[model samples]
Target: MNSSSPIASLTKHLWSMMYYFVRTYIWLSLIMGISITFLMAHLVFWYLDSEQLERFVSSASQTSQQLHSNLVTIFTHSNNTCSEQNLITMREDLWRAPLIKDVVHIQDGRIICSASWGNLEAGLVLPKPTIVWPERGLQHWRAVKDPIKGDIQVNMVSDGAVAVLIVPDNAYASIPSNYPNTGFILSTEDNRYVFHASGPMAPENVLTQSGSSWRLLLTQQCNTSSKALECVTAYNAAPGLFGKGLWFISVVGVLSLAISALLHSSILFVIHQKKSLKRALRRAIATQEISVLFQPKVCLTSGRTIGIETLARWHDKHFGHISPDIFVAIAEKNGLMPQLSRLVIEKALYQASSLLKTDSNLHLSINLSMSDMSDPSLLSFINDHCSGHRIPAHQLIFEITENSASGFEGIESSVARFTSCGYQISLDDFGTGYANLSWLSKIKATEIKVDRSFTQMIGDQDPYNRNTLSAIFQLLKDLNISTVFEGIETQEQAEYILRHIPHATGQGWLFAKAMPIQEVARFINTPNSSIQHNADAAR
Candidate 1:
């Protein structure tokens, strides 16, 4: 075979791969576009409905406020005159205000005026007003005292009549024909209806409160009163609105189904294409595609390489390059993070074991997820792997994120079990979650990783940031837990930590990016590694 024929075949294979991805992309784009459109339309409708409801309620509340203000004005003016005639005039004025359903006035234990009946029963005698006081009247009185308006219902008896200014029960029942299905009923503090109006399409008996001033109830019904022109307008609009909503929903549903079918086809195509990609990646990993990159942690006081944080890197044969951030998220989503994590742990242990043979004092730290912790078989897996590989459990540390440890239900038990197994537990990203020193102390973590936020701000001249770090460092120190500062990218950051928090440990790009096992091994064997040089430079 010609040598160039193989190269041409490789080129054709690459082109086929590209064509597959492009086709998949087109299908995914169409599906995603449809999905996004439907979602956005639904969101818009939801938002509009919410806003409309709020506006309707707000209008009702404003109407109630006006009525209350009018009543209060009438009471204030009449109380100043302190005359039965004045009260009678006030009642008459309120009755003619178009919205007021009824008005009854009580003065000095006598019903001076009654607007609902259009007459005052002058010769009638009434019982004591105290009988109508609701049980929670005292609480209402306290709430309404002074600057706050009183909304409580109290019994008032005068001239053989019980006069109560009630918020009417059906205020929302009589709204004008043109208005939407919206109306409200206003009640006094005692839950008695004072004013009520209704519209043709309003909801039935929906009650809302107004900052304790009034209780508003609302309801609506379809208007079927007239077969004439005016009633036809309302009848036509109701069906139109309902039909429009239904049509929109139906169209969206059909489109969504189509999009889903397209998406399913596209996903299958992508999966087929990715099979080759995955196989190449697997082969690379089998032949050392997985690399152990070390980030150095230095002793703040001595500026020595006290520990190394291990990060995993992957390279694919067909895909050429891939980011762990992307693949890791994909792996987790695909339920493969456990397997990926196990591989990393095995490789890390094997490497750490070899390094330990040369230098027993070195520490190797790796990150573990909450899912890993909750795995019933994890402990036994670790035990088996470590024992088989001749790796000491004490030499490896597992870092757990604070967000993962939020619900401490099974965490304590899990931590205890791991600690008993000679595995060190470090709380990663401290001070960013509900995890405090009390929680840390309870869990009895061997180490706490101060979030990169604090480390990044350590060298800031700003007093607030400096003071915050100082307080956090002091708190961690008092807890007798070792502190590891993450994301130290500069010599200034290292120096600031050394000067301010001499007891804390530091780790970041200031040391080195994570490397493969062999490369890390080579660095460890080097007489003067970059990690040591950086530490010495910092000193």
Candidate 2:
């Protein structure tokens, strides 16, 4: 190339400057513009697809739940087998139901009185229940080649006792045909009570999610392939989930904005929520606004406080007693949990140390989140607090929710160190949220806190629930893991648990609601004062 003249050199420099500007600013702008456009397009696409998926899952789940409920109710209400007249009436009533093809009451694995069978068949084998919850009733049961209808039918065993309500295969056959591509698979495999009844595609084609009674399955092709996409998108089935897919877009629109306003306006009316919350939380930490509440864990037989679960309570001046659930969730989501948890530990340790000084038998329980365990310095941090406060580690129980058990999968060895160091591990909310033997076996758990749902279902007449609950408690007992029945609000419940487990630990309103540090100290001071008098159930 030839050497440039002075003017040519100036022109080249200007061109280079333009290129630099384009590279640094213009190109970046172009990339951002493209990214935003793609994002908007993706959001639109997602909104459409999600609408159909939501419809399929929602309708299928609702239909399944209604059918199961009807089955259970009919069988449970029927006392000592249905009479011939009652059987005819039941079949007639069931046929009127939206998806009821047939109904039946089986005795000893044989169908005796079926909705379609007037005289009743001799022997009709029913498929086992597709899903069975631990203490909840059996559901989504299927029977193949019915002795009466000739078509395949599904059954729901009302605790498999006085009845087995049979539903026709066609009950779940077509998804209205009005709503297309969107279909589902309901199953009870692996303890999941799912419901699947034809249409859409093979069971393997769809993805699944488990809820109370059924698992909602949806395929990736729901959006594009279905001709009834519009109808499906327009339809709403699940409770409180109408047009939920269009929420973000609807935020700027009519119907949803008002509803959104109604929902958010009530909760968000607190002034300067986001920034104020962060500041309030941070200030609360600095000022030690976190007060510890001790809920007594009493022995079922002895009715004495054996352990106290340490709960952190924050009542912000501006917010005025924000729920622990809300505040804690906020702290975790915002990455303030570690600091909040640390503050909680320090306060608990200081107080627990004082308590230990007086009574050596008392154990202080502290709840731990996954993040708290993930801290590389957590063990050391805990050790420092224990050593610095002169409190024995055994007196402190680190309660982890069952949901968090799997989250600490790789850290089991790390957690084993905590347990080995005399810290007791108790799985909290035992029956809630996918708490199974698999996760139970993974952690070094010493105690299981059975959730309130099972405790609430305890009654003299509820044989199905009673037997199921007994079996669950017995299984835990066989595992050699101590049990603590949580949310015991009545003497009846407390007595029932003790009758079964005898020495099992009991927590919740029945003993004492979580009390302030001062109240707890007073309660500990006067152990024989009768917890009933000391407990203010209003809390």
Candidate 3:
């Protein structure tokens, strides 16, 4: 078997794991998103319907109140001592008033005054009382005790009469233009019609009385002219609006799910390709497919290289130069991150062990992801590798990004394990992703790598960016945790950090680009390399 057989198997396993995870995640997300959207639409429609009903009821009630108020005003203004002839004229005037259907002056429970409708003879007296008069022609009526004028006087010889006004039911039927389907009724408490207006009422009469007044009731049907047309249109359209709404939601849901499936398929395809690429890369690592690069971490004050951060580089025989970011992201997606991390640790440890024999003070920093922190076997792997190589744990620093500290289930335990084993912990990309000051004490990280955002803006004349960096550096200093400013590509940035945040250490292209392991070794070994000379001068 080839030396890389084990890595090939691991890569295949990683590809399988990634495919399942992506598929599951896509399915779950699409289902949830579509379901929520449909539910929200349903809730919106229900809310609109409820608001329409409430508005319709409110408008009807307002009209009724207005009619009551108008009648009370008219009755209060009338002279209670008016003679029969004068009462007849008063009734005629009131009957002509807008919304008053008919006005009848009742004197001693007799219909003495009425509006002339085809020689009906205004002020005609009726035998006995017209208290139980036929309601066949009446549209609507309302009887209200005039609060200001009090009740009308009644004699034992003659029952007191009420001034009955007959108004077209059209007044109450006048719904707001927006709600044409709404129906209304305005009648006395005893169901007497104040105005019987909706369409022609049936031949049935419901009579009831309030106090000494007789009231007649009639029923009218109401339908929205527009809604009736809309209903017909909707029915002819096969599926109605409600059904169409549901169908639209279903289509959206199906499309979303289809897209999710496609996405999942694409992810699987990429993951599978990555698995092959990783297999080839791992074989290269085992047979030297990957090359280690080192960037010296020089002491800001001393200017001597105190540590080197290990960076992985790859150049595939089939595919030319691959970026660490591309491969690293693929590795993470394909579940090969743990294996990759182990490989890096092994390579770094072996190199550090060799370097330590010559320079006992030299330190090696290796980057770790949140996945590595939760890996139960990671601590053991590190301990075993170091012990096998006879390297002290104190010489190694495990660097983790700020994101790893957020909701990291076993992070505290992992940190404790590594720290107890004499491995230094550094929080990398400190200003990014949940970089809480409180976590510094909790994780007991020995170092913090200030994110590129703050470092890039270090020399900016913008007060906002400058002040923010100043605050962050000061905060780190107060915490007693050393900070390394990342992405320093300019002389201005270096000067700014040195002057404003003198306590910080940094590494970037300004110092040295990550180079091949051989180049790194040669640079370190060079007696008077600019990096070494600068380090010595700074110290």
Q: Could you say which candidate leads in TM-score?
A: 2
TM-score of 2: 0.49
- Point out the worst 10-residue segment of candidate 2 by lDDT: 225-234
Runs with alpha carbons beyond 4 Å of true place in candidate 1: 1-289, 402-407, 433-439, 461-467, 521-539
TM-score of each: 0.47, 0.49, 0.48
Q: How would you order the candidates by lDDT, starting with the best? A: 2, 3, 1
lDDT of 3 at 91: 61
- In candidate 3, what residue range of length 10 has the lowest lDDT sum? 227-236
Estimate every model's Cα lDDT from 0 to 1. Answer: 0.58, 0.64, 0.59
lDDT of model number 1:
0.58
Which of candidates 1 and 2 reaches a greater TM-score? Answer: 2
RMSD of 1: 15.2
- Per-residue lDDT tens digits of candidate 3, residues 1-539? 78699999999999999888866878766666566655655556445544554565466555555554445545544554345665666566565455544444454434554443322233444334223334322122223322112243211111124354433344455555433222334333334323322222221222221111111211222222211100000000111124235677677567656665666567668768777787876676567566677887755555566778999888887878999888887777667788788888888788667776567788889998867877779999989988899888888888886344455656788788788889999987776776655556567898888888887886678998878877886777677767787887776676666665555676888777887556766656654344334444434
Identify the runs in model 3 with alpha carbons over 4 angstroms from their true place. 1-288, 402-407, 525-539
Q: lDDT (0-100) at residue 371 of candidate 3?
A: 76
User: Backbone collision count in every prediction?
Assistant: 33, 8, 19
